[model samples]
Target: MSLLGPILLAATLAVPAAFLAACFVPRWRDEALAWQWLAPVPALLAAAAALVAGPFDLSAPALKLSLRLDLPAALLLAVSALLWIAVGAGVLRAPAAPLDRRVAVSWLLTLIGSLGVFVADDLLSFYLVYALVSIPAWGLFAFDPAPETQRAGRVYMAMALLGEAFLLAAFVLLAAGEPHGSLRIPDVVAALPVSPWRDAALALIVAGFGAKMGLVPLNGWMPLAYAATPIPAAAVLSGAGVKAGVIGLVRFLPLGIPLVGWGEALAALGFVTAFYGVLVGVTQPNPKAVLGYSSVSQMGVIAAALGMALAAGDAGAPALVAFYAANHVLVKGALFLAVGAFSARGVRPGLWSLLALALALSLAGLPLTGGFLAKAASKPLFGYGFAALLAAASSAGSALLMLHFSARLPEAWRYEATASPGPLVRFWPAAALGALVLPWLLFPFVGAVGDALSLAKLWDGLWPILLGGLLAYALASAADRLPRIPVGDTIVVGEAAFARMLRVGALFDRLDAAFSRWPAAALALLAIALALAWAAAP
Candidate 1:
């Protein structure tokens, strides 16, 4: 490997690590917070290098660690680094102080982990960075004094830990399955198809990464987290933080070989989650919550595409999914910023509103936008089957949900005319514009630009969005009639179930205490001896 590649790759991590380390010094902490946005520069450069110069790998055998940047990883890393830089600059600017030390610490740590996961090539390293991406982020939202924010943070952390457990177990199985006991991700995944625990590993992998991506039953944290977090934090977490799971799935899944049953099951789950988000999202009053559901819906589409690819053993699915997800990373991030921007003023019929509408519909694959290309790129994976039809249908659903989100933004608008809306809010339009147009630059890696702009392709993208717009219009008149599901729909029920389980555990504790008595213990011992003796006689 060229020295430049290694230096860039190593610095991608080291620079962030250095900033985070400096946060420990009292004097440097403020400066660290002010300059934290710059930490992603190296990562952005590394991503550019990989994309232009091709994939590269770096290893430290003595330390048993490795890093690699493939097309999928590079695509995600570049956009994600952009998100971190843009959002971080707005949130952590010099005047934004006095930023809380904890929030700063959390942001830096989360930034490092978010960028780290894309390059991590080994199972152990991936798991560690994945945890970093998932865990410290609780502070981003939960540091607020609001009761709901605190609750959201707790729920987010619980889900993160649970997901970690699933991933760790799956990784252990993957490592064990490799006859050579290789820790490198590619080696382990190559062996996964024939592993004795293949089914079990795939199941765990789905459950673990699915939790991060906000798949159903586990998706409850997203609405609450996004709704509760500050807009800048929401932008990055929704944009960059969650892609850890996408990279996880892209890296770990044995996508080169078709596992028909598992792939079909995953795709089915994805479609279910997709429509489910739309059905629930339109009823939501909070724009942030609606966007959170939009993410849930969007992630479902990615999962479905991947599942389809997995089912067909299509090796090209990773890059296509990355392209799709890259669009999402920008769009969703900018939409959250838009919420903040729109909220800064009273609702009016003007350019801002028009821009908001454009952004919202873009998620539904409006032509000429990045989303349209993302959807176009994903078509081959589904290949005109029922899954393809469902994919198109999901775009319509996305349109309906996003339209609902745009309509609801006015509810968050401030009546105050005298106050400044702050830098992050001010930066929203540029972010939104970038989100819409930037995918054109990325589409070429996955597909030809000329093909994406063809008349048939344009119509293909338009129809679903039009269908969704019709649904939105129909629903708008009857909006009040739509059922209002709670922000984290299933989470409340899960909490109640957990409470009941705790009560049952208390009862078992009392029973155990009762059984611990000397006489009871002696009787149990005698019974065990008698049983053993009887078995021996047999």
Candidate 2:
């Protein structure tokens, strides 16, 4: 079979989607939920095929749905597929509570988008896939309507819609610039350097993808969303859904061209976000919220890496960034799952929990783990410069935040029995094992395995971990002295801003009321028509 055969990719998406369609029959909804776990299998297969067979393209005759997968896309798709599978399995076994069909539907829709985004070969398909990934996931936030969840959902939706607006504008600008009317990403990007609206197009692209990537200022939604989600849902959203942005950046950004000013600006924004996430993360009490902040920080590091690569006009950066992001997909997903596991199956206070804790801390680039491999792979881009120092320091902050997470675990799990193993038996081990091993295996394909394991690399990975450990230990000793802060600090500030907007909304409501009066409406229409007539007269 051709490695990029549309059959496999189509099946991956279509089968589960067909099942979701079946859910319209009340009799099939439960059965469909049971089988939703199978939706990502085809995606997994397509990813494997793409990785093995190189890039391939397929197009439909009627709808013109172009499907293609390259090495970078396949790598991300594979990891994302794995996350969906693992999380789906966990969800199947989770305590039988009232299941939310809306959440399930959202999951399927997001899955389709997540899978499609990886293979979409043209601009219109990419936009459709991006929309699928962004819009439906809001249902995951809205399944239950707690204040935090509602607020988080609102923020997430707002950012997502804003991102969509920017990306659509960028896509429109890109299409307009294409002399041949080509909507293929490669074609558009090839023309971008010489395009008249290059600057505006790039700005829109950055803003659009940056919002999804949770870049600073636009990043407020992440902590709020992750903090409110169910553990399994959080795992997939954090691990897989967010990668839509990563892949978008990889595919959309013109890497061959050097745009020094723009690249440096992005890098600066990234560095600030990296440190900003940690600074806020340390203050938060919820482990999940801390992890969310950590994602913001880690993605910042990625943005910095991409910026450096762009500045240098390095083509090798995408694979390296993918490797880094792929590792994060596994580790962060596992960590979020671990939170649930540890909570359900009480850790025996000492070694067991400590080992789990240690593994969790590995997200901070702890030595001899997937996180280190990710960090090591990116080292070349940073190259012993200020960027390198900043990246390493971010690792230190990751360690500290993870330590706070570990400390919080005991309290969260205190009510459960330590002796009786719960769901963690099935869930945690798979997640942890995936986090530790998958990156190593994938490293050789994208990077040199020898570079990943060298003594110099080992030390580079080790010291930051050690520093974080020492800091964690010191904080533990002075635990009481630490002031308790709310999870998602700036989120509180954001909420206040939202409240202020509500007051503004009331004023706007009054304005609309006045504007809708018959005399006022007629007068506005007349004024607009006269203005148009005057402009046209010239």
Candidate 3:
């Protein structure tokens, strides 16, 4: 490719890498934190450049690394870069004391990996960046001494490590199955359909990435982790970092070929997660926790769409999925920032509350909003019949969950301190506005603007939201009667099981101790010798 493309792509990672490197120096550490917001600028520029310049690849044979930016990656990268910039600025530029060095370093590391995943073209590089997005992010919130936060962090780390193992095994299978020994992602994926171990590899790939996307059975960490983190960190992690799994699915799945069984199975799982989030979220009192559940639900919608696309062998599904995810990247991050802003002590909760409400409802595909367009863009994948109905039902579920989120906000505002809000708090509205409008600007890249605004399309998006609103109102009186599911619903069960396992291990330790004692050891040896003598005589 041309030099401009490579340079811009290289600078996306290089700028963040340089800043992260500078953080090691005691003198430059403060400076690094001060200007950390500027790090994503290159990525933003690269994303914009990719629009006109088209896809480009940067390869380093010596380093065994390759990076490519295509339409799907660029869509996500651009929005994610914007989120990182806005939230990073607010966090780092706050009027408070300087941030802890570790948080700063972890932030940069996570930022690099978050952006890096979109461009990484090789299996090895994608795995490394995905790890970067998933692992060091523990420092973002786990530093708090709160017991719940610590527990959440531990669970988060365990899930991340588990996901890594799944992905690594899958990658190995993909590599082994490739006859040419090509390590490039496209090469491996193209070969996957014909690979001897195709089914096993696809299963692992779905499970590995599914964990990150908060898909069912593996989704326990997401809500807990998000609720535990500070708002700014939550915004980025929820928005940008989580999408690494999305990109993984988009890149690795052979969408060009139909896999009816796998697609349907994945779609079924996605729908389950989508509704499950709503069922549990309305009962939640914590606004942050509610939003966390909303993410689970929304991600499920995306997964479902992708799964349908895979079933039909729709090669164009990647761009549509990316567009849907791109809208989510902004809206979710903005919601977190809005939470921080609304929770500020001295701020009057009136006007900001309405703004926050609009942002929240947008997730439900509110008419003419970015979410509406996102829903519209993905409509082709769902088509008519049961899948289409589920998509509408998901919108309603999102609406119900988001409305619940808004209802929980007043309580959050009431308990806050009386201190004046920071610049970051004030910056929230701008971020919210960006989340609403930016998708409209980018919608043309994926589909026609006129189609999203059609009378029929508007009605399609609206009824579900209205139904959800009615449900929220009807349930408001009985919300307290709903059982309180913990932030990570299934995680409590897992933890209890682990505790029991530990007790079992303790019993084994005692048995081992008894067996190791002189009398028991001598008896065992004597018994073995007698048995050997008997056998020899025979």
Reference-based lDDT, each prediction = 0.88, 0.81, 0.89
TM-score of each: 0.92, 0.88, 0.93
lDDT of 2 by residue, 291-385 (tens): 88888988888888888887877788888898889888888888877777666654455766766676777788777788888888888888788
- Per-residue lDDT tens digits of candidate 1, residues 1-538? 4777778788888999998898888788778878888999999999998888899989999978899998999999999999999988887767234446788888888988999999999988888889889999997768777788889999999999999999999999999999997899999999999999999999999999999999997899988888888878888999999999888999999999998998999999899999999998988888989999999999999899889989999988999999999999999999888888777763356887888888889889999998899999998998887998999999999988988887788876542122223887778888889999999998888899999899999999999989998999999899878887899988988988999999999999999888777596798899999999999994
Model 2 segments beyond 4 Å from truth? 1-4, 93-99, 413-425, 474-491, 501-538
Worst 10 residues of 3 by lDDT: 412-421
User: Which lDDT value does model 1 have at 100?
Assistant: 67
lDDT of 3 by residue, 41-86 (tens): 9899888888766898899999999999999999999999999998
Ranking by TM-score: 3, 1, 2
Q: Is candidate 1 or candidate 3 better by TM-score?
A: 3
lDDT for position 526 in model 1: 90
